[model samples]
Target: MSEAVEPSEWQPDWLSELVNRSTRSAILSTPFTSDQTEGHLPAPSEQQNDPISSGNSANASQPPLADSESTHIFDYREETRLPVTPSGERSVRRTLKGIHLFVRIEILYHNAPRSSNQMITVNATLGTGLYWRGGQILELGGPLAVLVSFLVVGLLSWAVMQCITEMLCIWPIPGALSVYVSQFVDEELGITVGITYWFTYSMSFSTLVATSAAEFNFWRGINDSRTIQGVVIYFLIPLILVLLNTMRIQIYGWLEVATGSLKIFFLIFIIIALIAINLGAGSKESLHYGAENWGSPTDFDRDAADNWVISLLMSISIATFAYVGVEVVSSSVLEAKSPNLSKGGGNPFKFSAIYIPVFATVAYCLSGVLGTLDIAWNHPHLPRLSWLPPDLNKDDKSPSRAAFVVIALASNIPGLDDTFNAFLVFTCLSCAATNLYVASRTLFGLTSRLEGGEGRRWYLRVLASFGKTDGRQVPLRAMIFSAVAFWWFVEVLSEMASVSVLHVWACECLAFIRFYRCIYQHREYLERENIALVQRWSVKNYSDYPYRSYGQPLLAYLALSGCIFVLLVANGAALWNGFHLLPFLASYLTVIVFIGIWILLKIFRSAPWSFVDLSQPKRVAEIFRHLHDIRLGGTDSTEDISEG
Candidate 1:
């Protein structure tokens, strides 16, 4: 059904070295399968010179594409037609319904591996510090705090997801938040929001690289053997990942699956082990001190405002950081052979199944241990209590190593501590590699004119010059750029994950409100033109979206309000704990930076609010027309799909 390919051309010198970094996305992609996609490929002038002239036969004036095999770099296409049923079934455009492996890799890879790593350091990473204000700001202390924080973060993340899914479905394109905002809202938003997202992911990856080095320190001798070994690992890990990512998407998906599954199984085992230990199952004494750990705080410490709520609020915000990468579902909207996920309630398969299970399981297990420990009446006499991880005070702050510490102290199993630390190292490496990979793609998408909008034209050109591959698949240059930047990790950036996440969540909500209006306007355009419609949006709100987002303006508003609420209150703990200038500034650093970037773009680009382009054929009616034609078993001769 596809055209025969031309012979391969010589590769560019720069891309030649990273040739292996490209993907099967080149092999599987069918660019501009319909006119809607091709229509946006060029404006008036470029249209005359466009090389991939879909239906044009004799374009003698145009030059050939540089390489016959070169894939288009900013290919933001989404194949939305679901595999339809046979004549026996009546429901139209039935979704794939269950988990698809490739889709899992796209969304889960960003959050799951890294979040799993978060579980290992639950006692130390600033996220759970919310629960233990009296002991250590960033360390998990007694068991009760862990359980409460886990559930709190999970619920907050779910709310953000509710807001994003619909917008992602509406414009299931690669540039993601930035691109959507540009189309629905304004170009300045598209540019700034996109860069903020890219910046957050990049910063997160760098912090992971730094964290990876710290994980190695746990194994190296205390006699300074750690310095050299940590340095070696810091440089080596990113190089290995850059090389690994050179392979195809299938390989990428498989790698995530293998790593994520192992990580999940490892965490699940840890939970069961803790529960067994709590019940005295493996102990010589077989102690069963049931639910005593879930009692009460021994002492009350009031905040600056003399209230405990400030401590709880700060903890919730910090806990929110643990769930940072969950929005990758929206950021990396994979090609689904189902009604667009947003319109159809939500992703029934991967979103609910794979993402939730691993994250929830980790939270539950970590919380179970923490909650029981915190509330359990003083059991200092019990030998098992000796195994609990030590408090991470500010002066003695090191790699939290909480999970490894717990295994070392609690269990008599000979190699468990070594084994657990080894696995933690592997998770850190895997998560860092995947984070870089995701960041590379986001960078690549930003440079392109995503769906014919005013993309980061000059900036994308500059970045792509150094970041793109010859095959135009993987952004190997971007990966290498990211790898080098890993060494430049800053402490403030590490502390800004929750703020960064909230920033993007707020943008997605705003974008959705504008998108709703654009869709309504597109319908009116069609009506005024007297165009024959496929999906009847015959009313004020059309129920024709193959995958309709669950709650639109209302739920979107709720999510936005929640994000704003958290952002405002998230900094109280830091302010109350030290009452210093730098910490206070750093607490709202992400918000300030986000706004600062947006303001700069507004001044430079000066994108007019009234100039929002709603004519890009992204409407549901336009999207579903060709799919409907194909589903009815019609060919080019049977139905004309070309735009009038």
Candidate 2:
């Protein structure tokens, strides 16, 4: 008050000075806000270079902002800073916390959409099938048979991945299997396949949870106690998975990364350990038993020379089941920020498409070879329970009874079996979580089709509600619905769930074949069109085509043939050894259900009887034009295309 300061050079009181310093600190500390404002549009070159921006076509279609709008972009950033207290003073800790919160929000906003990294994709694909089912494959078919089955199935899985990946690179839509099948195949078949696939994952979740409970029982040395295992299986495990999935998808992705890394390390360790054990590194008496088990009786009947063929066919079905999750990467394409773009780090989906089947195949073949050498198929400690019949005991094999555990026990290494069993438990839980995530997302995709329409049907409105996302973009209702519905479904038919995997895969293969036919016909039509139109619409142009799989049309045919062969021989063991009622029903029930659903949908929804007319030039042009627009980062222009 004693000295009058000019308005231009005003000095604040102590409280005002503190407030000003806090505000300045907050703004300066916020990294994103300092460099860029909200709704800040990048230059065209920068947009093309940016992976996230390149993939998000909706942003490219937005109108340019006015000058006033550009300045106001920072207003939200300013409002998020530290608030002034009544006395115009704030604590140092509070100021720091505010800055920390702002930074975290900004970071999450940028990174959350692009959460499906390489590690997560690998982990989600590498499920519990190999760990739990490896011993069974070895037991059914000797080392040679197991190796052959995995190699064959691996080839089929690889072909299927290539076919699905090509289509996904263009569409990248959620619930992609159904949408593609509907467009290129029959509509009723597509809906039926989608529902069946969703059920398959849901049932698989229950199967994996039960498997995890068994692994836990093995760990605790309480195999006879059903009550504790039931509690863990039905209640504890499901609760944990539900809580995990209900959070932001980023959290699920990171969790998969951690678990997937552990499983991969375990897989590497086990393979090395088996090889070491086979080479007499950890043997009690330093006895090398390389290829000794290959000469052991491969067939359970142990009578006929041709029984090995039956065993190989039976094991192929199990091997196919093990490879089921490899294609789940396609399901995740929708959530990925830059699914088709490879500008920055390489595209995750493309990497997964190539990596999963190859790695799974090699790992499976190596484990089969080493596992068979470590112990004979008929060893006393091989975990084949005598109380249950041989045909029914496949579902009862626990981690403790797995071939790895038998080898660990034989190696005379103290606590080795315990350690392996613990990892198996973790693997089972990881796979269960993955299955649940896939199931919920599949359901979310199906329900998404029901959105944005004023529907007369109350049932459709009910289904559409499940598609709605929360503030964090988590499909909470879908997650809840899938969990509840599948939990009860699993309780009723756990055994049948294991068999449904083959049927679901078969449907996927058929869908891919139809997809290939459509693509081939379109290409042929484009070749006959005028050169300018052909150039505009041709998928052969790399600039317009986001990604293309090699050996396509040929690859699609191979996958279809291999899948058909597997379906014919999947239940051969039962047929050869005198058919058992439960196993027979389990093997073919999904087929019956699939056909039933297709018929129902055809009648109620009036789905088309035949596939889409791909030979028509107009249809081909429209399909290619939509794809061209998507490649150019334009709005989806296919809304006018009829569902029929």
Candidate 3:
């Protein structure tokens, strides 16, 4: 049981606002049980602090909280704790899980919703984009690439985290990030960000499929399986993942903890192994085969460039997926316990502060050293087809004919080959499992939105009844539905790997560009608009990062600026380079169409047209005349000034 509160002599202007937001968020987060209802009311100390308390105490009156007065808030201290169960009662723990709702919210709200969600086990499964074909690159990039990517991703992730943390730390809502991002950003930015998030989720599922396929391919070669056998084995991995996900959340958490431990173990072990092998070889060496490998006119050189770049990109793509789940913490900010005292929400700064450079460094040391060792011995040759440590390329019967280039040159040592093989196997399995969990959860979040509001409503209603309301809530229906979606989506992506990497690269690049533009253009409103939402929810001192450390907001300004230039070139190259240009054109056009659809949706949803429109409500009416086609039927065509 918790201690009884005493009235504080000092009061801040934010106190009433904080209490009101906390109470409201508790009410909205989930259904509460009779015992859990205390969270929805004022603390006993707060009740004593009330001006009316003096009169009541003088009259020797019983507390008004015991009466059925039904004011804006009440006290529920006596109702919070349930009696402890007997030692033999196993079922009691299961029942007690539901009671944790109020307690979790209190901790989250006070601590700032971001930390709780970010530190928990599910975060490892949620934020990493482990679900796509190109999801492994960051996980395997060398130090130079990892360093660059980390700077970019770390800052971006941090910015997003700060925005979310500020908005929901005080109030702590389940859909917290979306709530703030939607409110603070102009409609253009809001809708675009929403669409980007949706696509990221979708692609994450695709990454999972691609990763599983790669791992299965590795395994098939190791075991000397035929193509059909490999396919069967590949298909079965996701099934096990789905079954695991379908169980209760605690079970899922335990599985993640176990799997995560294995992953970290393998990653650490590989790094140590690579360092040992390198040290034994008695020479520090460069990992790159040099700029010469980039490309040349000779057929062999051109082919080498293509293979190396493509393989490197593939690795980077996969690594990017690993980082995707990092943002999953933002979704459950509302259920954090005591958000005001804790007061951190979706601040990716905190989460990614740990995520970006740290993971990137780990990836570089592990994969880079391994690659260096492979290349040192193999001398720029790809891995063997036999799936053995002496071989960089596994003999798997996948459509990917390009071999895994072993960058590690230290393979000359005795017993090293066997150890490397063991390490590779563990890597494949760990990455596969991580991807599956991410894919499952992303699908669930996506499906929850597609189901309209009913799915979320029911999830909240259940919590409400338990008096266990909090922002970090989970909707079981969403998870189940997501698992089903992942099952189908993975299959489709795995079968579609034959398409040229250039085409796929272009599509991904364009999508990234559009997302960057949306957020960049409305950076100010994106931060400012979350205040009301933060206030309403009693999220403490919600505020976004004021400035990005990396130059300007626009992504087009970076050294990677050439990549966007390449996207344009790739568009033309694909059309002219041989295969039918029509398919390429169609796919490229579809990407544009998707962006356009989101823009139109924002218009129809009564979202403000620009950042300027966020301040001038009257201006909204003037612009609506020209933008009447954008209006939708649900919410009013104008901003709800009263609500703000």
TM-score, one value per model: 0.67, 0.74, 0.52
Q: Which of the two candidates, 1 or 3, achieves a greater lDDT against the reference?
A: 1
Residue 182 C-alpha lDDT in model 1:
62
Best by TM-score: 2
Error of 1 at 252 (Å): 1.7
> Per-residue lDDT for 555-594 in model 3, tens only?
3233234333333442333233234434344325434644
The CA lDDT at 79 in model 3 is 14
Q: Sort the candidates on TM-score, descending order.
A: 2, 1, 3
Candidate 3 whole-model C-alpha lDDT, 0 to 1: 0.32
Model 1: what TM-score? 0.67
> In candidate 3, how many Å is residue 188 off?
7.6
Q: How high is the CA lDDT of each candidate model?
A: 0.45, 0.56, 0.32
lDDT of 1 by residue, 420-509 (tens): 566666656666665665666566556432222235345434554542343424556666666566466667666674467677777777
Lowest lDDT sum, 10 consecutive residues, model 3, at: 83-92
| TM-score pick, better of 1 and 2 | 2
Which has the higher TM-score value, candidate number 1 or candidate number 3?
Answer: 1
* Cα misplacement distance, residue 16 of candidate 3 (Å): 27
Candidate 2: C-alpha lDDT: 0.56
